[model samples]
Target: MVDRYVAAVDQGTTSTRCILFDHAGRLAAVAQREHRQHLPRPGWVEHDAQEILRNVLRVVGEAVQDVGAGPGQVVALGIANQRETTVLWDPRTGQPYGHAVVWQDLRTEARVEELAADGGRDRFRDVCGLPLTTYFAGPRIAWLLDATPGLRDAAAAGHVLFGTVDSWLVWNLTGGPDGGVHVTDVTNASRTMLMDLAGRHWSPALCEAMGVPMQILPEIRSSAEVYGLTGGPVAEVLPGVPVAAALGDQQAALFGQTCFAPGEAKCTYGTGSFVLINTGATPVTAEHGTLPTVAYQIGDEPAAYALEGAIAVTGSLVQWFRDGLGMIATAPDIEGLALSVPDNGGCYIVPAFSGLFAPHWRPDARGVVVGLTSFVTRAHLARAVLEATAWQTRDVVDAMDADSGLRLTSLRVDGGMTSNNLLMQTVADVLGVPVVRPMVSETVSLGAAYAAGLAVGWWPDLEGLRRNWHRAGEWLPHADPAAVARGHEDWTRAVQHSFGWSREPSSHDGGAPSAQPGR
Candidate 1:
């Protein structure tokens, strides 16, 4: 008998990856390719949507080929993508109007500010469960309409379509212009700021507020269900496999971690770090700057909600150290260089590269490296880089605790960055919680596979998935309390310095920007 497998395409901010998994949830084969990140302006970030689609198709073919599996043996394809990366395309020609506005891009800051001024931020809180920030897709799409000529008119006329990365990949995979299903999962739709949290559908009111026509929105569906079959160029490789599941990457990580019960939480350290704590069926309006989002919805089951704290830069900070500073030849080299120093040497590297996100929401903020002195070496900066990742995780975990009232004694961690022992230990030390890395660190992809596999009856149920999860390693907090406090104090001071750097005097009334009105 031939062994059946599920393929998961995880399209992330920095790269695209495909992983094949067997029934046991073991990774059979994997392929990845990094793409260009177009930083056209100080606060603008873009990606070629077509390039991402090409990378996705290539990696999927490579992974399946490496595993010696035919398309028939592949039960289904699951998609987990970087959330909130907006792409607008013409359905007729299957070409994007322009580059995708990345989630980290702050190009929508002024637009978000305009909406916030009109009481748009808090007004939709009850419906969408998100604030007006550059982090969500609504503002970015709105900005695209105003910035891109003829695009808005086309969208209004139903000639153009809008989707986050997951929707884009799924559209092309199914058939693109040739009868491809245009849809987004509930989890992805929740981040768009146009979906009603309780109703689980597009809100015409919010659409009017953002000036986005409802005609261009994708159909909202559950996280696990057959959206369509592979077609077009994707059919050349994955011919008829059903697209069984689609999830925002972080939510996929949560499911991949088997955090099925309320209060169970996980933090995925990828291009950015997201800490999501399951809140069960009821959406908890966050009071601590955390965003309320859909976790996942399995077949006819009620949608699960999560209180999320998102940090826009984590692993990418290491990337900058490699590419920008040339401190390390590769990403992995940073771990060794960071360990060379006993500490950060009192330095704090706050990488607000696209401006601060989550808990702060300061789009005016810029990257700042504080406490730099003549005595500081490259090793100290490297250590600071790793420390920043830990501190940022602590910031979200702290807010998650405050909002959910669930004290996190341990964190279920996944993603590429979790492989760094030094970074993992620092995370444990800073958060004062045990950090557990799963045996299969590709939980993001596995989560996608789990959803698809479950849909096709590849796995019996959630209990089967629970048994598949096993911890590979663990880290416990060993730092002294005083040291942690001192480090955090200095980190807070450094973050303060980063704010108000790019904002016009009028934006802040010639004073420091006020805390975003509500959590």
Candidate 2:
């Protein structure tokens, strides 16, 4: 019998990757390419949609050829993408209006503040399960329509279309500009702040409030289904293969980690860190600042819900240490440097580079390194950098406990940062729970593949996929509880110093002060 495989496209913040997985959920082949990040102005981040599309095609072709897989052997394709990255494009040419506004972009911060002034940030929480913030797509869409000349009128008239990265990839893969399917999965839609939590559809009230036209939005669909088949440019690689699934990267990690039951949780550490717990069928209202979101939906069955805590900067902080400060040659070197020191030496770093997310939701906060003294060395700073990510994870875990009234017993972890043994130990010590990693560290891609395979009947069911998962490593808390508590207290103090560093200008104000460019 011929071997069959499921392919997944992981379009992340930094790069685009294609991976082929075998029946055992092990990676058969992989290919990746980095796209350029465009920073046109201060607080603005963009990506060329055309470049991303081209990269996706290149990687897909490369991955398939790498394993020498036959044409029909690659059975299905799934997309796991960075959510809330807004793309507006012309349907006629299938060309983007401009660069895509990344989730980390703060260009919409002023508009978000304006909207929140009326009813506070949580005004939309009851309906959409999201707070008013620049992290979502609604405010970004509104800003694009207003800033671009004649865009509002065009969008309102249905001349332009709006989508997150998943929709963009799906539309292009199916058949861009020639009967391409324009739709978004519930997981991605839930991050836009324009979808009703209960109805699982676009909310009219949110459209009007965000100044977005209902016509421009994509049709919301389930996470696992055949949206369309590969056609157009994508046909060159995997012709007629079903595009079976679409999921936000973090949710993909959750699914990949096999966190199918309620109370099961996973944390993915990448450009950012996201902690999501499966909360069963019903959406849980988060009182502690975590956001309720759709985990996944299969066919016509009810959607599974999750509570997510998003931390804006985790692995990116390491990137800054390597690139910005030239402190180390590469990202992995931080672990070696940090190990040279016994501890942080009373130092702490709050990486609020693009302002904080989750729990605090403070866009005014800036990155701060506190407790700096003559005794602190570069090694101590490296340790502090790693500790920052651990402390942020602890904050979210605490919030999750408060909202659900259940303590997390263990955490399933993945992403590039998990390769650092010291970092994993730090996370376990800080959270007072065991940190576990699966044999397949690429849970984001594996999750996408699992959904795709299930849709095409390539896999039996969720239980079959769960059986494929195997434990790779585990870290247990060894630090003194009293010492950890004191460190957390000091970390909280350092976080407070980061707040109120940047003030949002009011509409009545004549002008705001000029700001420096961000990383």
TM match of model 2 to true structure: 0.91
Instruction: Name the runs in model 1 displaced over 4 angstroms.
Output: 36-42, 146-153, 316-355, 364-384, 482-519
- Cα lDDT tens digits for candidate 1, 281-385: 988878777889999999888999998887888888998999998889999999898888899888899998856766776758889999989989999999999
lDDT for each candidate structure: 0.87, 0.89
Flag clash pairs in model 2: none
Q: Tell me each candidate's TM-score.
A: 0.87, 0.91
Error of 2 at 428 (Å): 0.9
Angstrom error of the Cα, residue 427, model 2: value is: 1.2
Pick the lDDT winner.
2
Candidate 1 global TM-score: 0.87
